[model samples]
Target: MYLTSMVFLLLGSSTSLLMALFSLYKSVGYFIEWEIISTNSNSVVMTLILDWMSLLFLGFVMLISSMVIYYSGGYMEGDSNMNRFVYLVLMFVVSMVALIISPNLISILLGWDGLGLVSYCLVIYYQNEKSGAAGMLTALSNRVGDVAILLAISLLSVYGGWNFVFYLNSICNDISMGLLSFLVVLAAMTKSAQIPFSAWLPAAMAAPTPVSALVHSSTLVTAGVYLLVRFEPAMHGSKLSQLLLLLGGTTMFMAGLGANFEYDLKKIIALSTLSQLGVMMSVLGFGLADLAFFHLLSHALFKALLFMCAGVIIHSAKDYQDIRMMGGLSKLMPLTTFYMNLANLALCGMPFMAGFYSKDLILEMAFMGSINYISFFMYVFATGLTVCYTARLVYYSITGGFNMGSLHSVNDESSLLTNPMLLLALGAVAAGAMLSWLIVPYPYVICLSGFYKMVGVICMCFSCLGGLCYYLGSFLFILNSLNYYKAVVFSGSMWFLPFLSTQNLMFQFLLNGLYLHKMGDQGWFENKGGHNLHSSLMKSSVLLEKMQDNSIKLYMMTFLFWAVVSIIIM
Candidate 1:
């Protein structure tokens, strides 16, 4: 079943890639719409848009999906429900493809909702407490994006159709367009795991590594960036774009800082994904949607390869994900080490690698743009942080001494895993240059000063040196210090973002509920609703009882008073 799926997906990928090339060469797109219903001023249609962007992204997705499924055949060996896992991943790819082809808001929701639902299933595939929690966080965080898309659909309903493509230009500068753009941006932010929404991306590493390679690296997380890219035309020059810029920069900086202090191998990669996502969003926020899309494609290729390498290592190490326990893998598994190094260098934007094409362009463009100093600092520092973490990861996992037990044996003899990785390594090596040439017709002409041109290289070189030095030095000694201890914990923990996303958010609501229980439910509501009513009823009943008990004399006096009043009226 896995082989058949892989074959079909590979075929689909090749077809899509051919179609993408043809579409790009011709500079044409085809839009197909099947009207489900049309009445008076309302219409419902199923739409599929086959453009260079959509087809090219679909090709990359299928290519990666095929590799991941093929990898999973070995990675998930002996699992009872491997078939179910493959099905869910296939569904995930289908959803992502659906989203890629649909320009209509209504049709987009169909795909958007599927991605969220299927992701929850994939995240909890392990069926454990940690997986369950991660799945919930992943589900709930994505639901925010889902709701945002739904709202955007409702807002677009007034136009007699739900196809947002038709209205982009007409609504670009309208007063209500800002609200629409805000909804779209909000949805993208949640889907891409930007800022506060980012905690779920790392938590989602509880799933199988194959799923991590597919979902986290390419399809699922990139959905938001794709959405923003599609809507960038309408959102340019809007307040929301500027806000997205700031948030993306912050997310980039934050994730890079956190990854440096992290030791978990999968999490380090996950944080790297988050940082790249921020770079994508920041580019979009800069109104360079084409550049963002370029980075998105190139990033998907290499990042997926990186995850697969991590999977092979983890499997060899008996599923231990901590880098501290891993060492000297280059001697034991030279091929996997080579592949890992290739992906790592590409991720760091080493010259002529897949990442260098898009990533270098992004940094250079940022320097040329009229961005604020904070954003400039983030771009520079985050680029450095990428190198720092990659260096740290390579040092601990590839070059450091073997820290595991002597009795353990690790090998890369499994062709099932290595073959897929070999395919992706090609992409990690060549996809960037291929994509940059294909997608970008004319090269960007930038006239930046020599100092600015060299800024990125200088920062990366220093960061790499710093990372190696820090790891070689007494890390324990530095960590044991009171001042550095707090800083390390803060940075390592992703600035307590997981706490803010789950515990802090949950606690805040719980604390508010406690206050409400004290002040409203138990205090004021009790006083005004049940307790006050009970007391008033009790007082009235007691007074009535006293009146009745005393009272033949009281009744006679009341009757005499009424008689006197009647006589006076007469």
Candidate 2:
């Protein structure tokens, strides 16, 4: 089974890479459409759009998926449902590919729904209570995006077709199409877990590590940013762009702040994914779709490697996900440690690393753009918090005192895990440079001041110092003091987002749904619809039966009444 899976993965990776190269070098694209039906000038069609963007994104997705599956072979070596897990992961890959290549809304929705369903299945693969809850959150959050896409499709029907690409030029000027754009943005926000919709991304860590590596890094969360990128041509200079900028920046700041207070290993990585996602959305908001795509690809390489490395540590630590329970593994598991730190450095946008090429470039361009001071502060602080949390994570998990039990044994597991990490590590290190050259053929002309150029460096330095202070401050005094308790609770709990998205928001919807069922469907329809008609018919039937059962007295009374009326008229 594993061998067959490997063959399939390798074939997919090679094919996508080849197509990406061909599309890039030849500057060619293919858009194929099949008309299924037509009525009143509207057509229902299936479409496949293969261009350099789609091909390149597809290649990265397939490559990461390949590494994840191979890593899972060892990670799930003896699990009884390993075969089922592999199948679900493959289904997820297919769904993402479908989404990447399609230009039509209907076809995109098919892939969109496929990703949501398959992810739900994968999230609940463990078949336990916590997994079940997490799966529900993941499914429901994504369903919002699904419903938005459906609405977009319904709106597109009036345009005579479901293909959005052909309509991008006119959509900005037309008020009707503006709603379509809004729905698309809302869908992307939910899918990408921006702000209020973000609680689910961290909750979804209940799944196994390989799944985490796959879902968080490329396929699921990145789908929204990719959608927005495709829709960006219409969104530029519009109110939607400003709204996206606000929400994206806030989400970036929120996630980075929350990660510092979080201790769960997987959750930290998940929050980082959220932060990076916000960065991509912010760039898209800045009308830099190409840069957003660049970051997306580069981020996938390192983020996936980061998760796999975490998996190795968690597996060896007997599934202890708390960073406080782990420390000083650099000597015991040197290889995993090395790859993890590399990924971390890349995440922190260290000079010349994968993240540096994309993330740093984004900050530079943001400075070049005409953005507000609020946005400027968000970009700077979010960048710093990213480094701060990363440093804290590395210190707590790798370089600190040994905190695990004496009986615990930690070491580099096997070639199955190491080989995949090594492959992704290579990509994590080099993908940024390669993608920059290919995707961004021309260099961005920046005319920033010296202060702006040094902002990123300054942020990293101050953030590093803050991280160091926290690392040593734990012993000196109260790190999380009573004065900061309120702040900690707010940020630590994701600003109470889990409560808001689930208990608060959904609870109202549930009540309304139940009320509709009782009053609208059952009560109102019973009294005013079929039930009312039935009662009126039954009453008329009873009156007729009583009149028909008339006796001699009844006939006499009727005759007397008619005679009296006739006399009065006379």
Candidate 3:
């Protein structure tokens, strides 16, 4: 029964993907029109006038979704709730499809909200306490972002008074282009988990591996980058664009650092997802919206492959996710190891891999464009950090230790898992080769001076080599002086700066997610008077229940007295 259900689900998703690809092909000359009724008497009409850009994004989304669906079937095999999982997965693709095709803001919001809800459900599908908590956090964070988007939309409607069609027709004229740009940027940062809004993503590793791959790598998070790319014209010359550039650059650097320090394999990948999104965000900031979209396309392919490889390792290791406990498994699991390392190299921006093309384009754009020297240096440094952390992940997973203990005594029974990893591994290698043809009028200008490319290559070499040396030195130092490394570096210091010796203060802050969550929760209950209101509600409810249970005569007399008082007051 489960097998049949899975087959049916795959069929539906594949058919939808094919239809979308066909539509994208036909969209070169096609046009669409629709009507949306408002609460008022007037009707708002719109047209989804397609062009090369929309078709490109549409095709990218479809191709990625098809791969996700195929991998999901293998990942979920033998699970009892296979049917339910497939249903939600398909719904997620449908929502993304609608979002890509929608002409106006309202239609896009409908699809966006649907995807958010389905993602929340998928996060909590395991029904465990940890998964439930993570899902709630994801939903709350997204809801706050949604409220900001709603306010911006309402303000635009009130001030501009332009219907859907007219707004698109005169997008630049109707709105305070500045305000619209700010709102959209905020929405994108929140959705993509940049900086202060980024804690939710690491916690979301509690979900199934397939869910993590689909949401983090391919579909849900990519929506934010897609939005910025789609609405580039409205945001071109605003302060928000500069802010996006700075924030995205900073996020990439910080996230790469965090990924390097993480012990869990899944958390490492989660952090990489954030770092890559930051790079894409920076590309959008540089006005290379087409390049940003193309990077998003390639990232989906390689990152998903990496996650699937990690899943295979975890499954074979008997659910052990800590990279510290894994080593030399390349001998036992040669195929899995090869795929993982291949994907990791691509992720590190090695030449000829999928990531190299997109990342190099962004770096070149940052240097050559109107962005100041400081911003350009920051981006280049972040790219170097990307290489450092990616190398750390690959080394730790395959070489650091042989502490597998007794877990690998038994092996994984499912051949289904290996099949998807093999397919994705091939993608990680070959996807970039197709980029020149896939995108129309390939966006990169390649204006880098010979000196510049040489400097960039040197930086890449240093990052990779430096990271490997650091990892090896740290390991040997730990083996020699175990107490020193643990007491000063691992236990006392922050994740970013591991040499700082302020143990008590750093430990307190780190335990609470750097005090950000504590501050937000305190502000909600204290400044908002939520605690006092809750106490009052509880006391009043208790009194009412007691009065109701005391006596029928007492209740009747109370009601009569209230009725007489009401009439006299009136």
Candidate 4:
């Protein structure tokens, strides 16, 4: 507790200093950097871009991580390895800082790989079979992006420099460097857990709650979005950008739908993160990197708060993550429920919350952009889904009956837990307006029809209807149709993405392919091609040596063979 308080104070000071720098840099832009390696065409430099974006983002990362650390002190009390957990979280923050500060891609690797490696360690920190499986899935899936980054670095060598700042400008004219855009998008998708790479995130819920709060908030998951925000100048208008736009919208829809079906408290929150990340990605795909960054910041605040609240609930309910097992805890834990509600409503983009500023702006832009109705419907559907699931989460977790058996106890408040949650809840309430004013110097060019302008509001109302219907309908047992169970099973389980990732056809195919390669290429090739080649050569050499050791008998045999060969030839 003493250490966490100290760390929070230290991080608070750092955040204030960075905010001051954020203010100062607006008047005079500056790159605080130190060159690490020098070459004729390229010099590898450790650089920090001190524009408002980096400063604001860096400040938020420090603040949230520090608060998470503080919350963990209470959340993790009595654990033998609490010290180890704290150190791991501290390292995660260090890597996150490195990622936020880096302007050079080569230097970004240090942070990028650090996040992957440390997250793997943290994911498996629980030391159980579930944790072990989740860790491997998380690490290996991220390994694809790591390899993509290394390939990107190699591809970057063609320009004789690894500084993305230098090359990003040339991206528009130098058609040759288009591959870099693809590589970057791929890397970002992997890091952010988009599409096929999306499975590891919810699986990562096997980690302790503090790790989820810190990592999912502004560190591990957001790293990829931040990377895209940095690379947006280069990737905008490219095929990769188009794909991100499409993929992002789909991810948002997929995750929102999945959240409605989910029962686990943590999984629902994880799915919400996925949906929010999709919103950021889609906006960036539309070439609005600033808007995307703004959403990223806003999402970080509330989402972190949401997870912290979930942690408190999980602790109170004695780790019953299933909402089915939970009930009306609002009376028991009024304070915690209030914080949870604030976070949930904010996540729903309820007016004036942090999510409203960015999400509404994104939805407005999505409607206004030169997109097909399919894309527009995706945006609208996904937005409504967000509200519906959040409403469901609140209804199930807080407003429902107390189903945790009579003996189990529920606490309404814990200062150790609520302190950090309250701090974040404050941000979640105010950050939308605050960040919008600070980050976006200009407003979005929203040229929607007046009727369309109200669509987002109406969509939320309709989403409220959907949530009401689902919640009221769940208890009423109204949906008894044939497809109802199928819909719940499919969408509720994240399109069975978890199953697909672990034991589905794709995993089976890949697993079999790997086995075949090991058996044939590695095992069979070494035995047959390698050893057989040596044995054949050795036998030939022995026969030649015998022939060369020519005595009278050998000469006679040779002569007889030659005569026989000659006869055969004739």
Candidate 5:
């Protein structure tokens, strides 16, 4: 089953890539038309829906899905339900591909919902209590986002009588469809796990490593960014775009902070995924939609590599996720160490790596945009934080103090795993080198002067230096903990502070995922009006149960009476 699925995925990916390249070269638009008569007028209209953006997205889905299929075959080798896991993975990829090629709102919704369903199944593959709970949480959160999108689509179709192409055309002309744009943007923000909706991604780390890689790198979280880019024309120049920018910026900062404090390897990667998505959102919101797409590609490459490396490490370490328990692993696991470090460098946006070009493009574009100095400072600060946390990840895992009693000794023994890491490492190094040529049309000549290159080199040097200082001072030593120390100082003086407590507050809020659901539940049940409403609902539910029981008996009696009347008539 795995082999067959892998072949099918690879074939689909190759076909999609060929189509994309053909579309690009021939300048022939990719569209599929379906004619439907209006219900009232009976007038036939053809919906022309598809374009380069959709084709590009389809190509991406194909490529990544194929890679994931190959990766999972090896990753799931020892699992008891390996066949079932492979089936679910394939179904998930299929849903994503369907989403990419969907031409109408209904088709897209079906694909989106199917993806969510398959994702939930994959998340709970372990069938553990925690995994099941996490899957339910993910499902609920994703359903909320999906419902918003579905509602927006329904409204557009019902009121505007606009199909996908018609809606795109209208937006291209007006660019002020405020309500529709807001709905879509809201949906996108939630799907991407920005701000208040950000807790689900970390929770979803309860899944297997391959699922985590798929969610973080390509399939699940990228859906939101893909939607934003796909509908850019509809959303440009709207207040929603600004909202997206702010939400993205905030998510980036907060998730990076969370990554710094997290101990679980998968959770750290999950936080980093959120932070990277936030960066991409900011780029897309700022009208650098193309740059966001480029960054998306680079991020997928390196982030998947990182997750795969983490998986191997975790497997060897007997599922120990704490970096404090892992140290000097370079001796036992040279390939894992090398690939992980290389991927981390790319993640940190070190110069000459795959991430450097894309991230620098975003920064340059943001600088040129209308956002003022404060926003630029925020971007720089986020960049610094990214560097710091990523450095900490590398340092603690490979160079920190080693306590053998806390760590298990296991050999790094999988050639199947090492092969994938090698491929990703090569891509990380060489992908950026080809970016300039790959992105350009007609082989146009461009050159950077010696001075410009020097400046770029120096900026990277300073970023690395700052990251090192932060790691040594804040993370490695007690006095270096400026961010944590500042929070302590700020909260220590209030008379209510001791009663509320810093440790309790931190766990109950930040570490407890801000207790958002609790807050919502409090509002729903505890307040005066809410309490009354809950009582009313409980009473109504009892009434509903009684009515349902009575209706079932009534239906049975009616059926019996109808049967006797038929017999008499016969």
Candidate 6:
């Protein structure tokens, strides 16, 4: 089975390379349309768009999914439902492909809903309470995006077709049609897990690590960014775009702050994904969709590797996901630690790494462009927080004292797992340089004062201070538990977001509505209306049966009485 999966990986990788080459040399964009229905007012069609952007994203998705599938062979080997897992992953890839190729809302929803459904299945694959709760949160959160898309579809009816690509040039001329962009941005927010929808991204860490790799890397979360990328032209220069910019910046800051306080290995990584997603989204909202796309690709390479490394550690530690229980594994699992360190370095936007080329560009753009204090602060603080938490995490889980008891051996025993990490590590190391050349050969002009230009560097250095402080501060009882307990615990638990998503927020209200529907709706309505109607029909049937007596004597007496009465009246 692993051998078969290896073949699949090669095919996917080869196909992606070919597509990338074709995208550069020979590909000319085209749209294939199949008319589903047509009316005077509006038309629905299945539109497949093959363009440079779509092809690029499709290739990336295939490449990342291929690696994740190969990696899963070792990780999920002992599970009873391994086949189910594999099938779900394959469906996930197909849905992502569908989403990338879709040129219209009608076709997009097919892929979008497929993603939501398949992701829920994957999240709940373990069938535990945590997985169940995570799956529900994941599903409901994405449903908000789905509904947003539906609203956008309705608003887009004025254009007479679902294909926004066809109308991008003309859309700017109409302010009334601008509502579509707002709906689209709202949809993007939910799909990308920005701000209020963010609780689910970390909770979804309940899934197996390979699923997280696939999702965070290229499939589920990237769908929203891809949407914005495709819709960029239409949304340009609109208030909706500016609104997204602010929201994206806020999400970036929020996630970065949260990651610094998190103790869970996977959740911290998940929060980092959220933070980077905010960067991609904010760039797009700034109307530089190309920059966002570049960051998206780079982030996928390193972030996927990050999640794979986390998987190795957790598996070796016997499912202990808390970093407090992990320490000094570098001596035991040298290879895993090497891969882990490389991925983390790339995540921090270290020089020459995958994150550096894109994230640096994003920050510089924000600095040079017409940006306000809030956005400037967000970029600087978010970048610092990213590095700070990453450094702190490395100290906790890799270099600090060995916190766990001697019960299990921790080493890189599986070649299957390490091989995938190695492959992704190569990307984490060199993809930035390679893709930077391809994606952005000539950089955007940043006319800033020398001191102002050093802002990003200053923040990075400050991040070192922040990381050390956070790590050391964790040891002090007063800081960890006493006076700052509320602040510490608040950020540590993602601002009680899990509770908000599951019990304290919209989902709880939804659950209550379901309960009301079951008890009040079905229960009372059934007895009062359905039961009464049933009794009334039964009573009428009995009365009719008694009146229709089949006895001949009763019929003759009734006839004779009627005949005598008629004669007396005459």
lDDT of 5 by residue, 1-570 (tens): 766776776677667667667776677775766667657756555443455556656665656555666667677788889888877877887677667666566666777888789989988888999899778767866777788878878667644564554576576455445667777777777678787677668878889897887765666788888877777877777677787788788778777766776778888888888889999998877876777877877788788889988988888887888887887777778888888988888888888899897887677667657896666667777777677678778777887656446547555677766765665677677766554344434432334456533444455567667766766775557765565766544322222222233235423654565466566656644664668778889999997887688687878887999999999999
Model 5 alpha-carbon drift over 4 Å, by segment: 34-51, 158-162, 172-176, 400-409, 433-460, 473-570
Top-scoring candidate (TM-score): 2
- Local distance difference test, each candidate: 0.91, 0.91, 0.72, 0.84, 0.72, 0.85
Task: Candidate 4: give its CA RMSD in angstroms.
Answer: 3.8
Task: Please say which candidate is ahead in TM-score: 1 or 3.
Answer: 1
Measured against the true structure, the TM-scores of the candidates, in listed sequence, are 0.89, 0.92, 0.78, 0.88, 0.78, 0.88
Off by over 4 Å in 4: 1-27, 32-45, 478-483, 505-570
Worst 10 residues of 2 by lDDT: 474-483
TM-score of 6: 0.88
Quote the positional error of residue 66 for candidate 6 in Å: 1.3
Query: Which residue runs does candidate 3 get wrong by more than 4 Å?
Result: 1-29, 36-41, 44-52, 158-175, 407-413, 440-444, 479-570
Per-residue lDDT over 508-557 for candidate 6, one digit per residue giving the tens place of the 0 to 100 score: 68988899999887888887788878998999998788668787877888
Q: Write the per-residue lDDT of candidate 1 for residues 162-193, one digit (tens) a residue.
A: 77888887778687667878899999999999
Per-residue lDDT tens digits of candidate 4, residues 38-144? 89977656677666667777788878887888888888997899888888888887898788878778778999999999999999998999999999889878988
Error of 3 at 419 (Å): 2.0
Q: Candidate 6: give its CA RMSD in angstroms.
A: 5.4
Candidate 2 lDDT, tens digit per residue, 30-75? 9988788999977667789999899888888888888888999999
Instruction: Give the TM-score comparing model 4 with the true structure, all chains together.
Output: 0.88
Question: Higher TM-score: candidate 3 or 4?
Answer: 4
Ranking by TM-score: 2, 1, 4, 6, 5, 3
- The global Cα lDDT (0 to 1) of model 2 is 0.91
Lowest lDDT block of 10, candidate 5: 491-500
Q: Which ten residues in a row have the lowest lDDT in candidate 4?
A: 1-10
